[model samples]
Target: MVPSIRFALRGATLLAAVSGMVAATMPASAKAPFRDLNHNGKRDGYENPDLAVDRRLDDLIRRMTLEEKVALMLHGTLQAEGGRGIGAGKAYDKASAQELLSRGVNSFITRLGPDPRTFAQENNAIQKLAEATRLGIPATISTDPRNHFAVTAGASSETGGFSQWPETLGMAAIGDEALVERFGKLVAAEYRAVGIQMALSPQADLFTEPRWPRGVATFGADPATVSRLAGAYVRGFQGSADGLVKSGVATVVKHWVGYGAEPEGFDGHNYYGRIAKLDNESFAQHVAAFDGALAAKSAGVMPTYVIAEGVTIDGKPVPQVGAGFSKPMIEGLLRGTKKFGGIVISDWAITNTCPEQCMAPTAEKPQGYAIAMPWGVEDLAEEDRYAMGANAGIDQFGGVDNPAPLLAAVKAGKVPLARVNEAARRVLRLKFDLGLFDNPYVDEDEAARVVGSAATQAEADTAQRAAQVLLENKDGLVPLSAGKKVWLSGVSADAAKAAGLILVDSPELADVAIVRVATPHEMLHPHHFFGSRQHEGRLDFRAEDEATKAVMAAAAKVPTVVAVDLDRPAVLTLLKDKATALYGLFGASDAVLLDLVTGKAKSQGKLPFELPSSTKAVEEQHPGRPDDSANPLYKRGDGIVLP
Candidate 1:
């Protein structure tokens, strides 16, 4: 058990009625106080574990003032801009973090886990500060997906030394329900070890659109596959196959509905990607992908930023606004039809202003950092945006620290105080249910042993190896002989030596040439900060490209073996004729690849999605259709095996 500074009860006790039950008229000395929440001399009804969760929430929410309630509805980040990256701060920033805690905001989306032990220490300090507040509400630390192999910049951050596994698509490539669930449980153990109680992940978005920048994050284009794996992910993370548990990480299944149907493959983070082209059938399929996650009783659901264009639900035309600002998407669709009773958190920075810097770098703000995504409600004031989102059933606002606008809106009668209370109940219920109110601290020493341990990493390395799809092996050329003369590209010499392979100076001098390459993409929309980093446009490689040129030159002299990381499906027509062998990877280390090559580990994955035949076929296919392109170079589930 974690040791905490317990506050002693004072001289007298005050009998009070809370959650409609009167406390027995007795001395406070009858029982020991539970952390002295509300800093009272006696134990409150909310602090008593004997009471039910709903009743405890009722007692806590009624005690909270309007300011405290508003603060509960607003979630801030460790960073001011609310971006993604690993930050290893040995000490907590009192000026930046304490100010928010003082304002009664205890929840934050933190990206501070550099390692297990250091991350635990940083989180403990923050929780201690929350315990010092008047109500002593424990801090609920949340994070982006950080246990992945190849983390994306804006979508998911680096693994922070956690056990590295293949991307979600790779899990789909392997399609093992048990293995995926094991990965989830392992992730939960590591996260809890580091004092993180909430996970803002398990993105249930489908990879329907071939060119979508964030498609790699999804399981696959198939609704059933995505739904099945996403549910397994939530079940594992939340520690129950049915619902949330006390020792589980509260999982948030996110970007709810149609985030993967971007017409031009742009993300909703920028203005250009705000409109998602969705017909009625396409939207239904998209919604179906989240069935498994919803069925697993996930603790939280985040609305997507994109507006569902050309769509309707139950014969009613959906509102032509971003899902965050639309009542039909939140209150009607998610809560009413789908029956999702979880906390509804809005995506980050939806209410902030999209100034020149947000759109593009201007002369005055050349290094633009602040971001906003008020896609359809740009005309409204900041306070109006807050009221609209709250009324639309947004339980919490992510990325923004201050609750002044919400407080102002409530005072002006724009938003009802009752709505804020409801939001507070939903938010506080999670904390209480997770036993955060009881024990929020973690053991730092335990964290060091659990996170990134060899046992967990061995399981992940197996997944990475099993997820690689062997696309081609001409004349049974795979299972390369270890002693053969080999030339490497994107592979290290140490890894080669470990695999017992002889290395040569050039591809011409070697018996076989092994080259690694990534899927082809164009950097379109360079003006926007997110778009500049996004993988958009063409998926076919040109002859002038360095990797393509090297492949062409090497394959002419030796039996060239190519391994491409399939973040997004690239047209493999260019390499079909030239290469003797092709291996498609979602995420794998040089050693994992070498193990597969030397027959130490057997290749087991099939194509998660089809590889397109040409750039013209990519442009012509519908954004919401799965594997409907003209004559795909490789069909879905296509793979080869060594005899």
Candidate 2:
């Protein structure tokens, strides 16, 4: 680390050099102010694009009031009118423009994505509204992963017109740093084209426990591999291997610490599934997985919703609070140990009210309305939670709109105003660095032209084709001739026909059969919102299961090819033994799979996480460890080329 004095000296020298260049190039009469952000008809330091980020941040924070700072720290959600863009001449909220203009809420996570042009328009409207405020602090709009096939409500979304690539694990399967970087660049471009400035993505959490519902969103089970891929992901999104740049999308590398180590493989999104078992030694490995992302200078980091059950730092038991609220987790670990100086944003709904519906739901009254993820701080008062979190290094609250609790806490000396000012500075610095204040509006035509263009789609198509891992190909069963009669399940008949395979009514009358199956899951808890949608529970295919039955019956009569969507690695023992050919899929489409089957494409990816031999193996393995099962069907890095 550079000494404060030396850093200051360097800054002064750079400023002198830059000022000399400007003076030498421009005449006094020709010079014009960069921006009139406050509409005062004069230039402010924050409004000047040429100023250093720190100088601009200092200027901006100095001008902000306590209420404005509190409101700025709250990362709210925006709703698009008609589910496309904000209503014309109106705030995204139903509130009047005067109400919005009075506050300093300048950052938001948008769920209003219908198309590229509409998304750009909505963001432009928000920026235009911000310009009318006392200080024209442009809003930094963020979104979850959208350039993918997976469309989990809170996790990832489908690309409306953006290039669709594999899930993060699929990128891990390919395991090419360059390829993942390319994919990230495309995602970054698509996001910026639509005026989205920040990306709440590139989850660096290791795929430790296979049954963890969010395993698919992660890079597979090795710290070194996860680190490499995570770094590439950040480099691509931020448009630099070194740090965040003006043209890049700010990447929030997420679920910090031990999120993937779900005890009993239950997700942390629910009350009953908040604990993640990580012994002192194993905890280090989990933290090490984020090294790559951190090294690449990820613009932000979001702490996990789960609590680390058995973690300690420097012989002290780490507080068993959600990472976002734990001083030990954030201030002590992330800041003191990892030295991440970027913005620390809390995961969604950390300060929300966990009503009866959210806490406990039955078959009839499922968890719906009041979604809360306060985890270890469930019983704390709202103001206490905010005070604890803001002091613990959380800069912003996700999924929260009202800033009254935080403001009250700050006013009553529960949370320090200094911490609030620091948080506000970080937020404003990011916006300034992204050049949002200069020009937040994107051309609608440019957005429409750039997003999901044929070139990007072609690139995505190739990635989809390469993400499939070949495991078993018996007796030249794969690369099946296009003229063969084929029976299909979980695969579209139209896709099979397009591959020139003659569709057969049943396996008995076909020369071959193509089947695609999701790694089987049980809806043990139908009450919770995430629990109902999550692919949870046993990773083995039982005989009575419909997908298993379909594969069995089809293989009974003809040579069957099976493709398992390994959202989480499945125990493929039975199918690998019975089917003539088998492949592992991350986010491949039916068309991509069919093309591979007909010799138009080839498998280029390897197994990302280990494929367990049985459900017993999955149960016996440690939640915090990776690829350590006693016996596995195929280990990580295992693959076969279908000839």
Model 2 stretches with alpha carbons more than 4 Å out? 1-34, 82-102
Tens digits of per-residue lDDT for model 2, 1-643: 1121110111234444654566557667636745456554456788877788888888888887788888888887676443322222222553432244345566887765567787677677777766666676777889888887777777876566788888888889889999999988888988898889899988889888989889888999999999999999999999998989999999999988899998778988888789999898788889999999999999999999999988888899878788989998888888898898999999988988787889889877888656898988888999999998999899999877677889889989998888988888888888888988888888888899999999999999999998888888889887987589988999988787778889889999999988999998899888898888888888899888999999999988989999999999899887887788898999988999998888899989998888989888888999999898878989999988654
lDDT of 1 by residue, 218-283 (tens): 898888999999999999999998888999999999888799888868888988788888788888
Off by over 4 Å in 1: 1-33, 80-91, 360-367
lDDT, model 2, position 19:
46
Alpha-carbon TM-score of each model against the true structure: 0.93, 0.92
In model 2, state the lDDT of residue 301. 96
Please estimate how well model 2 matches the true structure, expressed as its whole-model Cα lDDT: 0.83
Candidate 2: the clashing residue pairs are none
TM-score of 1: 0.93
Residue 390 of model 2 has an lDDT of: 94
